[model samples]
Target: MSASAAGPDWGIFEGRTLSLLHPASMLGMAALSVSTALLGFQWRRQRTIGGEINELKAQLPNLNGAKTVSEALAAAQSAEMVDTSYV
Candidate 1:
């Protein structure tokens, strides 16, 4: 059967499909899907940020146990600065 004749439906998997009968349910499912995708993105981003922080800490031993990326960078730069002194 043609798709339009069967009405609007969502294909969940390769062969399986969810017949969209109620508009409210469809809306709810769509909202849920979007939120879940956004959550996944945030989780991945958090992991990447954490990895970066760990790498920076390993590379710069003078980081002073900084938790965030900005703080780690600042500490690294400051640690590299040479103090000027004249006698």
Candidate 2:
């Protein structure tokens, strides 16, 4: 279509500005998308690990206030019929 009726077709920012901007804008958008995706992946990974840790905490029983490994084992071996807690 001819722009004769539009009068002179003078666009803002003259000489290849729009053309140069297109590629630069596209590159910037690509970088933004990639960084956002990586951030999302990191968040998802942390959430998954956090959930797994929570599940483990829920499933396992607490050590009956024993500070050391030897003490814990000793407590488990003692007190008959206590189900034998592991360290």
Candidate 3:
């Protein structure tokens, strides 16, 4: 049988229909929709952050190598530092 034909009389759902029409139900539905949207936005933001972190991690080796070279040069110039006393 079709859904409409198998169901109880329409009047049986009158109270439920009225309840659905109430403002609180509408507000609840709106809140649920907004919450779902916000959750999706937060998930997208987290994914973007993760992607950026991975990109930065991939660049770390080059950065570390450059820093090592700079430190080595500074260490070689330590004799210049020895001539300048804070005292």
Candidate 4:
């Protein structure tokens, strides 16, 4: 029998003849859609975080690696020495 003549019904597998309807299939589809939305949200958040990091890096001073290391070492050397008598 044709689908329309039977009755008006809204279902995933209403008109399809070869389709097999299972409760688990509906759950699986729901899970797939939820996961897809979550993944898209996560991707967008990560991209925003990455852009902010890049912007901060650009705004900060670009120090030479060797010069910064030497400055740190000099500062450390000028600081008071820690006593190891207790150890």
Better structure of 1 and 3 per TM-score: 3
Q: Write model 3 residue lDDT over 1-87, tens digit each, in one string.
A: 577546556675656666677877889999999999999999999979988999898876443333576786666676457644664
> Which 10 residues in a row give candidate 4 its minimum summed lDDT?
12-21
The TM-score between candidate 4 and the true structure equals 0.40
Give lDDT per model, in order.
Answer: 0.74, 0.80, 0.74, 0.72
What TM-score, computed on C-alpha atoms, does each candidate reach? 0.39, 0.49, 0.43, 0.40
Q: How many clashes show up per model?
A: 0, 0, 0, 0
Mark the regions of model 2 whose C-alpha exceeds 4 Å error after superposition: 1-12, 54-70, 73-87
lDDT of 4 by residue, 1-87 (tens): 576647646554465632555656888999999999999999999879988998897996644443675776666676546677955
lDDT, model 3, position 37: 100
| C-alpha lDDT of candidate 4 relative to the true structure | 0.72
Task: Candidate 3: count the clashes.
Answer: 0
Candidate 3 matches the true fold with a TM-score of 0.43
Model 2 C-alpha lDDT per residue in residues 1-87, reported as the tens digit of each score: 965646535575444776688899999999999999999999999879988998897986667898876888888888655554662
Provide the RMSD of all predictions against the true structure, rounded to 1 decimal: 12.4, 8.0, 8.7, 8.9
C-alpha lDDT (0 to 100) for residue 26 of candidate 4: 86
Q: What's the CA error at residue 70 for candidate 3, in Å?
A: 12
The candidate maximizing TM-score is 2
Per-residue lDDT, model 4, residue 3, is: 62
